[model samples]
Target: MPDAHPHPEPSPAHPRPEPFLARTAPEALHDLRARLRATRWPDAPEDAGWSLGTDLAYLRELVTYWAEEFDWPAQEAALARLPRFRVPVGGLGIHYVHARAVAPTGPVLPLVLSHGWPDSFWRYSKVVPLLTDPGAHGADPADAFDVVVPDMPGYGYSDRPTGAPLDSIAVAGLWAELMDVLGYERFGAAGGDVGSHVSRYLALDHPDRVVAVHRTDAGVPRFFGDPAELAPEEHAWLEGGAAWGAAEGAYAAMHRTKPQTAAFGLTDSPAGLAAWIVEKLRSWSDCGGDIERSYTKDEILTNVTLYWLTETIGSSMRMYHANAAIAPAQLSRRVEVPSGFSIFPGDLVRPPRAWLHRVANAVRVTEPERGGHFAPFEEPELYARELRAFFRPYRAAAAS
Candidate 1:
């Protein structure tokens, strides 16, 4: 990996970005370990595994490993090697990774990748290099992208919102301004989770600027149009969504309603934070019930440690509340921009062809055999290929 340094110095055309290095003060890390070690034990039934909630036995083992063996410094060093920068966007210093395409054989289209909650820019880190330099990774160089992944406000290294938390629409406006500052006249947008909503808004609000949009899953179904118009697959999807919500939507409900109450313990206890995030990682991925099957201990800790060190968990969850307040009309607006969907097998809810077409100018859709909600991190190569193929047709338009 290249040594970390500021790229593209300040010039008349483009504002310079302050190079950002991931470094946690020694005292902060020490305090985290102390908290992990001092956690008060919680009792669970011997047979309760993940049936009730986060498994107590697994959490205990993970916490012990975190306190005694997890190396934050090494992980921090590895993260710092990525080309990270913070630039002023809408009066906030936004942290993002800007990696120019390597040895492009054709037009290098600028692409901004948005990440959702629970994980920040870290969600797309593994796939950055793959998209930026496809030839080196055994793919066509013409498919390379000038990749940009921004940490949404109140997530990762970005500044937390001070007043009202930003919903997806507000975040999309911020991203448009960000791309403007980066000198990209037009670009492609893609994301999953909350990010998928942001990208949808990006295409809706800036149709002229975004050549195309791609997403992993459609946002939680809204059921705006008449029920009689729905196809069988769409109806089945709605039923599946309701079933998933009944079984697994409690966390989202808490985030939408009482985030602050949960934030207290999550912020104070590293073990609590890990349990909160790890359970979702296990349940939401194509891991076959084992989280390590998708992400190793170090990979999982890197994401959790970011939340722990940044103290952004509360602000991150508050986004749900902000999004909840979106007007029904805005939520119902259909996107006209060219769009694509690559629904991973383990993702939360898959919107069928009928639902996808009802929402956007659906052009391409695929169902990869493996991966899940966190596909970029869980299956980087496959994720990269999806973007490469979906966006290939739009590259000429982007270049023009």
Candidate 2:
């Protein structure tokens, strides 16, 4: 692979990226294992089976495996193998993976992949390599990308904001600066979950710098405009989103309203962390009630373990509170940049074409049969293909 590190700093005042490798100390692992083993597990009624929340029996089994069999060292070693770096962006040390396209047959576009809550850059780990080296993956080398996956503030290895949690727009500003530091004047952006909102802001705020934008979910539907003006399909989509929220939005509401309170329990108890995250992994995936069908025990544990080791569950959730403050006009702003959407069938809610057009310059939209909310992680191959095809026409924008 070609070196993807940024060019020499333009000035001493400008901070340069330092190579980063995530090495958890021995004591941290020891404490994590002990915490998993010492959990004061609660009981669930027989046949409760995910009707209420995380199944106690399944959690116990998962926690037992986490305590005894899961290997953090191996997982950490795998993570370390990626081309990782941390740079000072706006006083915070932001961590990201910068992988240059291998053997490009055409202009290599720079792409930034942002992640959401519960998971960090881990969301794009599998798809990064595929995007960076499409030829090796049985695709046209012209479709290759110089991929950058960053851990948004308060997630993964990035330092948490001290005063105010960064909303999607704030993070997007940081990304524009980060990409500038990495010598990319214009780049494509894509993400899901909270990442989708951040990517939206990137295009909305930096239309001159972002070549194009892509997203998985269109974000939770809300009316910044009059309801009577909306199409019938839009009304149906909004109604579905409301129904889904009543049943499944407790986690997000908690994140927005009381993340700090929930954080303490999740941060202190490994079992609690797993239960909180694993439930979403099951509920929001194409796993059909069997999470392991979508992700192995190792894959699931790696993400959860990163959260535990960093103790970032609280900080990550704080983004919800920050995002809740975005003005209604900003939330309703339609992205003019050429945009694409791949709405997976198993995701939280699928926005109709009219709704997408109402929100974005929807040049392309496809509803693939597989994957869900975590499409990058759930269906990386499909996700990679979605990106390559969507951004192919926009490569000229990045190059110019």
Candidate 3:
């Protein structure tokens, strides 16, 4: 192996750090509340609940909480306490939270976390502290991690892509550089949804730097041989995922093809934005058809409010279009790095161990009973434990 943290910052292509401070002006908050109050809702089907989409009755209740009860100032203040900063990566300023290890002398591991759509660094906020200070959280101090959570380009506070299309591979490259910017030579990668795709690429393309990889998904499964090659369970899991997509993946097709058109309504109408994101949050969560089972009014609204306040809905949609252009090499490349998988019972797709081993050198795998799409947000303690356990074998001083 060569020097992973091979050099200091001023990464040949980008120089100078651009720190970020997250804040929302009084005008923005007031405007959001006014829009919520002035919303003109659509009529619900006579007996419909969430069958058609986001339940109309539920949306109204959520909107009311968002407008009058939810507190943006308090949430903003809470987030500001995280060690947030910005730095140029590939000519764009990226916002990230870098929470250093808070453990006593032992192994020091740098772990970079990535988040998926309808969310950003907010997705990993709760788990960062626990991972950094496992001792305080009643976990092994030897399992502590120096965590870095970045807002993907065009998502959250990160600058949106411009001029050309930006896909997951590109984002992985940027994240690789970001670790270098923070002076970490060897690190581990973890994420879900789009972030899962990015993690796969990070390990595939930069295996030397990414010591190990962990993900909530194995990305889109690919099978070329006869169905007989797979076990009955594997075969069923593949077919099941495909069937689930056929039934519920319309939003993705629209995102890949007509995002710009959808953006017009989402970017302009707060209600439209809420409907677009809230539906996925409700459906994908393991809340057993009741959205409240997975998230509180404040929790749900806070994420929705971030998208509304930042006006990044359009750019976020554009990611689907960008990913559509992925080269075959990036898509088919094997993840040679040590990989781990945590299959949650309620997640939309939970492939068996055999399926995961086909994609990567899966070293560890577990099935936690709780959680859904947003594992870190839904079950922070469990999420942190999984990451700590998976990365324990690779923990050491930063690569040099």
Best by TM-score: 2
308-339: candidate 1 lDDT, tens digit per residue: 99999999999999999999999988889999
Per-residue lDDT value at 122 in model 3: 87
Residue 387 error for model 3, in Å? 0.6
| Model 2 alpha-carbon drift over 4 Å, by segment | 1-13
TM-score of each: 0.96, 0.97, 0.94
What CA RMSD would candidate 1 show?
3.0
The lDDT per prediction is 0.91, 0.91, 0.85
Off by over 4 Å in 1: 1-15
Give one digit per residue, the lDDT tens place, for model 2 in 68-87.
Answer: 99999999999988899999
Compared with the true structure, model 1 gives a TM-score of 0.96
Residue 387's lDDT within candidate 1 is: 99
Q: Positional deviation of 116 in candidate 2, in angstroms?
A: 0.7
Task: Give candidate 3 regions above 4 Å deviation.
Answer: 1-14, 224-228, 397-400
Q: What's model 1's lDDT at 388? A: 98
